[model samples]
Target chain A: MSRTNPNAIRSNRTANFLIYALCGIIAFVTVYPFLYMLSMSISSPDEVVKKTIVLLPKGLSFLSYELIVQNTQMWRAFGNSVLYTAAGTLSNIVMSLLIAYPLAKPKLVARRFFTVFLIVPMYFTGGLIPSFILMHTLGLYNNIWAVIIPSMASIWNIIIARTFIKSLPYSLQESALVDGASEFRILFQIIVPLSKPVMAVIGLYTAVGIWNDWFTALLYLPNSNLHPLQMFIARLLVFNYSSIDPGSRLKLDSAVTQTGVITQMKYSVVMVTTLPILLLYPFLQKYFVKGVMIGSLKE
Target chain B: MEQVVVQTKPKAGRIRSFLRELKRDRQLLVLMLPAVLHVLIFCYIPIYGITIAFRNYRIGDPYFALGAAARWIGVQNFLDFFKSIYFSRLVTNTLLLNVLTLVFTFWVPIAFALLLNEIASKRYKRVVQSFSYLPYFVSAVIIVSITLNILSPDGVINNAIQALGGRSTYFIGKAVYFRPIYILLNVWKTFGWNAIIYLAAIAGVQQDLYSAARVDGANRWQQMSYITLPSIMPTIILLLILNVGTLFASNTELILLIANPNNMDVSDVIGTYVYRMGVVEGRFPYATAVGFFAAVANFILLWTVNYVVRKKTDEGLW
Candidate 1:
């Protein structure tokens, strides 16, 4: 295809330039806040107070980092987040696999029953109060199990995992069955090994979800010591300066050393909580796209 | 939708066949036991607990016994919610917030995808895509913190405005700005990740259509309008239907984190209301009633949206 008009070609080039520029600006807007946060976190407290540090750190200091590192409760929260994420993701994968595999088999008995049973709840929930009451009744309230047990199996993940398993060639499982392998062996030895990519996809989703979860801790873990990294960060943000009433927020700015330390501390916590996921994203980005496609695309 | 047809024999022999099948797939049954039990206890039991809405559920009520020792007062809690001072405000705020997001953000990803499709350089596209997708991985707490920091009286936005000879504004604390800021952040976090679906759909469009359009003297815009947009309409409609299913559901965590007492007038949604009333204030029965009403509305919305989409476009979540 050739453009006959030089004027039209020039106009098309302009349009292309505009599109690229818009995209670039949007990308910058998406990333600039984190960069600003990073710059503020590293800047000297005096510089932070006296000047508006936009793009770069002025009088860079590790003072905020030093303070964060010295806090044992912060470290404990980080450790708790790791513990929950690891255990929660493993449970999610296993439970999802257990349910998804059988459901993916067209020959399984009560498959339709199980499907409806699970899918209905995806659209309707017991609501927050009922779930809270249920947690209390089950002796999970204010306990770590409150975070882990209720989320052990996500129906959406199960559906995607089931779809992935269903798309795998039936012949693989059929041939294993013909060899007198038990159902468990077929799942472990055949399906599990073959479904590694989907497993990775769901695993990544579950890990990220668990890692990012603050609501669970906020609602369930009223005890401060049990708070995960996200909950701790949320607490710090809202209660950063004792009160966010306009008068106090203004006054708190002048009392920078006493209260404004929280502003820098907030940025440090944001980075610490977010950095691992951000750092891991590039490596897992391909799988993220794959997971979304697998979940959304119709068979 | 594809139906899984399980062949059956006579009705009288169904139980016998099921038993035989169960025995044959005992290992499968064993594997499903734990998950089934977990779902039953955690998911179904809480669903069963919804009955508390009709009863004055006390703290020490027997866990398994429905309304035991607590007098049943059907519809009183619901009536209380309907008559409460905050009722209309909560509903309005919840619906307005979600509808605003739906209206403003629903097509942004499609537009982003279309723009991304125009890029000639693959490497540049990938870099931009990665950077845009970065915010999706950041949690709600950090995103809200970032928002609050930016819109804080002395934050960057205010600082920039001051530089431009404007007065500083406390955007976050103001009720008027809550919905816009919330919608903006929602779109900012999601557009890139959501665009990937449309991007995948656009990639599937036949290359010959573009070539044919180009030969017909069509420009890039004409080619996109004629070919790419039409090809991705089904995916777009499907996603739209799914979004509408949650028309009453606001981003609970985001709202809860971003909203202060001052901004509560605009930011209080059904989700946050439930959290405040149920978890914070310990109004179990009343909160459960409100939540039940929300659940019913959400389910009806989901069903209606799915039905309409299926009828009109033959694209829907089944």
Candidate 2:
């Protein structure tokens, strides 16, 4: 039964209007900066840094984006980022499905031990240093495997996927078993199709995790050439924008670089890198909005 | 803490029961094999590396790989950190950052989700949610840069300040404004998406409670204050406890993106400090020690909260 009350559904149109109007303003406040960044990147840098410009571009120019694209390091980073996201997502899905399918069966041996091992890391880790040193000792350092492998499996995603798969009737699996279908065959052919909704959500989560990941790259990846797009642009914005402190011609130049122009480029880098996720969001929108009720708390 | 509770595993069977269960359902065990390997190799493998936090660790020259030859510092690295100047500053900044963000980013979304739940128009709610959710998908790089522009000395906010016959101030450069901007940016980035969970909780709230409240002569605000708020209390409490459980985990990206040496006094939290000292500067053992100490503090907070929660409510995190 749906939880909403019939009696509580009164036609308070005026209150609804007021609430919605406030929501609109809040949404505008939220979306405005990203929009400003987009418009500014296409606008000439000189027009962008004007003290009083908020709405409407002073004049349009693509020189900012042109500079970002031509940087070559940005493109290299983009290639690295795409590689990282792809390999990482593929690994997450494989690991998640592999773990989840078995956990969902309810009759598996040592399921509890595996579950604890899977979920404990979700709460705490040895922090960054130990993990970095571990990766280094494994000889994955400076290699793309360092970025792609450690994040291949997430215990939290496994548990969620397992929980979701568990909710499916065991009869489906049982029926397949009776039909003499192998367990691997059933999981691949039957369970995978039924579990599309959760898979989509987990896929989106893994993709976003990899796409936004810079810390891992920063730790294991010392080579600038191997830097992911987000890190490369992030370094430029965070490092270069403040390269000169203030009060000289050099200060003016740093300020010029630090202007809405540079940060806007950073925003542009964000836009370009995150575009795949943002675009894929609509397809996942139907399935990806998960309720926290199940895995939220028990202790 | 949240995860430790949900161990969805079958009980161990005696030898007879094991053979009986396995013979009866060999297919299921076969299906579960891949996940077992994934966790054993990926999750547990790295956990063996926690020992590096104990040893005098360096990158490729790992402590564990050396076996008996490994240099054992016993708690020396941790002792060195406590003796150092920046320990308390790191602890305070990390806790304060978490507290402030847990207040702002966590609660605002709960409120927004409640408000969004009240919307009768599904289409309108969808649009607003999509708009808000858009920013979460945006990287930290974008969010910080965008905020820097809007808050910069000659940017929109400061330009407005100048128009009012006031001097423009450097918002980012000033350490005082750091926490507010950090929390505010977090709210802006996460509030909408976070609200979705509370909306889900509110959705699960039975219609009967609202009807009962209305019959008892409740108005909208009263119904909200009593029925709605109380209905969502479990979710709220659960989330609150979960947030408190990890009270020391700071957003390294937010701090790192915004922090310069100038604002280090205020902005340097546990995460950023460790990153700067250990990863960025390569003081492997010293940084590893402090980081391990911070992790232990987090674990203690997690266990303490879980114990208190269990004793008080019988709903322990584990």
> Highest DockQ, which number?
1
Model 1, span A48-79: residue lDDT tens: 87756988888876656766777777888999
Chain A TM-score, structure 2: 0.81
Give the per-residue lDDT digits (tens) of candidate 2, residues A158-246: 87788888889999988988999987888899999998877777888888878887777767888888989777866766566322122
TM-score of each: 0.93, 0.86
lDDT of 2 by residue, B125-150 (tens): 88988888778777787677667767
Which residue runs of candidate 1 sit more than 4 Å off their true CA positions? A241-263, B1-8, B66-70, B309-311
Q: Which ten residues in a row have the lowest lDDT in candidate 2 chain B?
A: B2-11
True-contact fraction in model 2 equals 0.58
lDDT, candidate 1, B91-193, per-residue tens: 9998989998998788898999999999999998999999888888889988888888888899888999999999999897788998899999999999998
